[model samples]
Target: MTTDPAARSAPRSSARRRNLLLVSVLALVPWSVQTFTAGSATLLFPWGLVGPATGSVTTITDFFLRFTMGLPDYILVWPVGVACYLVALGSALSGVLFGREDVRLTAAGLLLAGVTQLEVARGFSVQPGRTAWPVGTVLLWAVAGFLYWSRAGERDAR
Candidate 1:
C-alpha cells in the first residue's frame, strides 16, 4: 500500500496546530490561587504574567503573605519554576514552527518540571488561615501529559 505524501503530512500539521493552540491557551489561564483572611489572589494568569503581577506562583503568593517556610523564603521564591515555564513555552512554540521532535519533547518535560516545582513550593507553605488552590498546576500537568504521551506515541510509531 502507498500513502499519499500530502495526506500524511496534513494530519501531522493539524496535530501540530492543535498543540500550539492548546499550549497558547493553557499558558494564559490562571495557574494558581489562594485566599487569605485579608483577600483572595489569583496568579500567573494572562494579565498577571504580562501585567502588573508578573512572577512565579511562589513569588505571587509571597506577595500576599510570607509562606512561613522552615528555610529562608528566598528558597521558595527562586525563579527555577519560572525559568522552566518560559523555556517550555518557547520550546513548544519553536517545535511546532520548525517541526523539531526534540524541542517538543523537551517542552513537555519542562512543563512538568515547572508545574511540579510550583506545586511543591505551594504545599510546603500552607498554613491554617489560607486556602490554597493549585488549579493552574493541576491543569498544566494535564496538558503536559497530553503533549508527552501524544508526541511520544508518534515518535515511537516511526
Candidate 2:
C-alpha cells in the first residue's frame, strides 16, 4: 500500500516537534537543578523567584554551606541560583521556539545557554558546586549544539 502524502509529512513534522521537546527538556534540566538548590537557602520564598522553595532536597546553596567552602558567604548576598534558573528557563523556551521558522530565536537560545553556563560557573567558583555546573553545562552545550546543527542541516537540505 502506498503511503499518503499527509502520512509521510506527519512523521517528519512530529519528529521535529519531538526533537524540539527533547531539547527543551535538556535546557530545563539545569534550571530545575538550580531552582531546587536556591530554594533551600531559606524557608521563606522570594516573591519574584520562580520554582518551589519548600522541601528542597539538594541545592548548591546547601552543599556550599555544609562544606564550609566560603562560597556560600558570597552567595548570601545574591540570588545566584535564581539568576541561573531564569537564564535556563529562557534557553529552554528559545529551544522550543527555535523549531518554528525563526532563526533569531535559536540564536537567542544559544546565547542564553552560554550565558547561563557562565553564571553557573561563576556560582561554582564562588561556592562549592563548581563540579556540578561543568557537567551540566557540558551536557547543555552539547545538546544545544546538536539541535542547532540539525536545524542547520535541515535548512541546507532545503
Stretches of model 1 off by over 4 angstroms after superposition: 46-78, 107-110, 113-128, 156-158
Compose the digit string of candidate 2's lDDT tens values, residues 1-158.
Answer: 44698776665566456555655565344431242343343221211223344544444455545754555443442344344434544554544555343433443454455545555445645544322234445555565567567768876975
Tens-digit per-residue lDDT, 88-109, candidate 1: 6666677678765454554555
Q: Which stretches of candidate 2 lie over 4 Å from their true place?
A: 1-8, 31-104, 128-132
Candidate 2: C-alpha RMSD to true structure equals 8.7
Best by lDDT: 1
| lDDT score for residue 4 of model 1 | 92
How displaced is residue 80 in candidate 1, in Å? Answer: 2.4
| Residue 95, candidate 1: C-alpha displacement in angstroms | 2.7
